[model samples]
Target: MKIAILGTGAGGRCHAAKLLELGHEVIVGTRDPDATLARTAPDHMGTPPYRDWLAAHPGATVCTFADAAAAADLVINGISGDHALNALTAIKDQLAGKTLIDYAVPYVYQHDSAHKWPTPWGFMPLLDPVDSDSLAEQIQRALPETRVVKSFVTQEQETVVDPKSIGGGDHTMFVSGDDEAAKGRAAQLLREYGWTDIVDLGPLVTARGLEMYAHFHSAVGLALGRRFGVKIV
Candidate 1:
């Protein structure tokens, strides 16, 4: 499949590299591919610069967000949760009839005095109302033509790439999408990537739980001093 992964950050790089390994024709989408190529700094997760990562994966290519979407059979949205909507909206015209796998958690930025706990990612509130309408649901509504599947969002960095790294891949992943076929496709990719346990939460609205899960993930990370995925025993 010709896949386009949006974003050049840790999430994007990890997902793109794995897809390339699986023999998919992967093209990464960025707001400015040219500028990304010029970046010398490492990603937030301290991974090597994206240019270096790209160099390692010669099979992958980069292009503007719109162009990448236009050419892909499937699009895996690896853009940051905060900016995903804007990025997809810019490329909306090209997404019709495409199975878009969205792996972004919508984390709203609080600009008011209610500044919350400080984390590695920044100062986001400890609790927010992602349930009113999850980010994935909003995206589906905004792009009525696209089949958006929400999966592989509960993890990040290396763990996002290989869930098996933790608990021997025994942990579970939740997938939610209005389109059943789209969820199946995303689940296939997850299994290809060595995910042994996958949970179908049903309907795109179930994304509310997935998006809210970021809080639980972060809390456990902070409490235990490490990242842990949710598992059904």
Candidate 2:
């Protein structure tokens, strides 16, 4: 599969690396692909330079957001939730009829005046309040033609990539989308990444609940000293 991953941040790099390791062709779309690749190359295991990476991997190519989405069989949105809508809207036309896997958390940035104690030792999801609608639902509403599957939003990057650190147990992942086939494809990808526990929580509307899970998870992480992931045991 030719996958285009947007954003050059940790989330994007992590997803791109995993996809590349899985033997799928990957194209990383970013504002500065060359620079981003150079910075991230060393840390990525078995990942070649962006130019060399593209050459070594058949059908893999990186370009700006528009071209990337236009050329990919699958486009994964790894951008922050705050910028996701705008970024997709810019390339909305190119994304028609595409299977888009959205991993976004609408996190409203505000100073924690209360300075909640007992914060987790590791990273936690910072959720945005006041947005009554979930990011996935909003994107689907905006682009009805595109098949959107919501997954990979509940856990941190490390947990998604290497589940063992979180206890090496069966970790659960939620998939919610209006399209069954798209959800199935996403679930397969999750399984390949070593996620043994997966739940198809029904239609896209369920994304709202999944997004809320991030908030609760964050609070718990803050309460505890560790980022112990949630698992349905």
Candidate 3:
């Protein structure tokens, strides 16, 4: 598969490495490819720069967002929640009829000047009207012609690359999308990454729950005092 991951940050690099390991041709997409490569410091999440990860994964290459999306068989929206909407919206034309795997939560990153305390996962606030709309639904609405499947938003970035590290043997993944075939394709990729218990929670609107579930996932992280995930059981 010619897979394009939209973002060279931790989640993107992790997924790109896994895809390459699975023998897929991976192109990592970013708004500014050069800037992403030139990044010398670790990201806010503490993952090493993309350049560092790219050094280990030689098979994967970097490209502008448009080029990556235009050349891909499938596109993974691994971009951060804050920037995902604008980035994907701009390239909706190329995404038509293609399956897009959305891994972003609906939270927008913001500095907490008033309080030093942070949410369980980290400090961030959700975009407006979250009760009525989800990030995945918004993307689906914005790109009505494209098939969008939402998954992987509730896990830590490490779990995306390696689901086995989570102590829970049956950690579950909830996928939501309007297109069955598209959801199937997304599930296949998740299976390749070793996710066994995946639940298709109906159509795209169900993403409201999947995205909102991040808060609980974070609470689990807090209890564990480490990165964590969820399980249906």
Error of 1 at 203 (Å): 0.6
Model 1 earns a TM-score of 0.92
Model 3 TM-score, 2 decimals: 0.91
Worst 10 residues of 1 by lDDT: 122-131
Q: Give the TM-score of each candidate.
A: 0.92, 0.80, 0.91
Candidates 1 and 3 compared by lDDT, better number: 1
Query: Which pairs clash in the backbone of model 2?
Result: 106-128, 107-127, 107-128, 108-128, 118-222, 119-222, 120-221, 121-225
Best first by lDDT, ranked: 1, 3, 2
lDDT of 2: 0.77
- RMSD of every prediction: 2.0, 4.7, 2.3
- Best model number under lDDT: 1
List, residue by residue over 126-171, the lDDT tens digit for candidate 1. 3243668788988998899999998887886578678888888888
Best by TM-score: 1
TM-score of 2: 0.80
For candidate 3, write residues 119-171 as lDDT tens digits. Answer: 55556474443778888988998899889999888787678668888864468
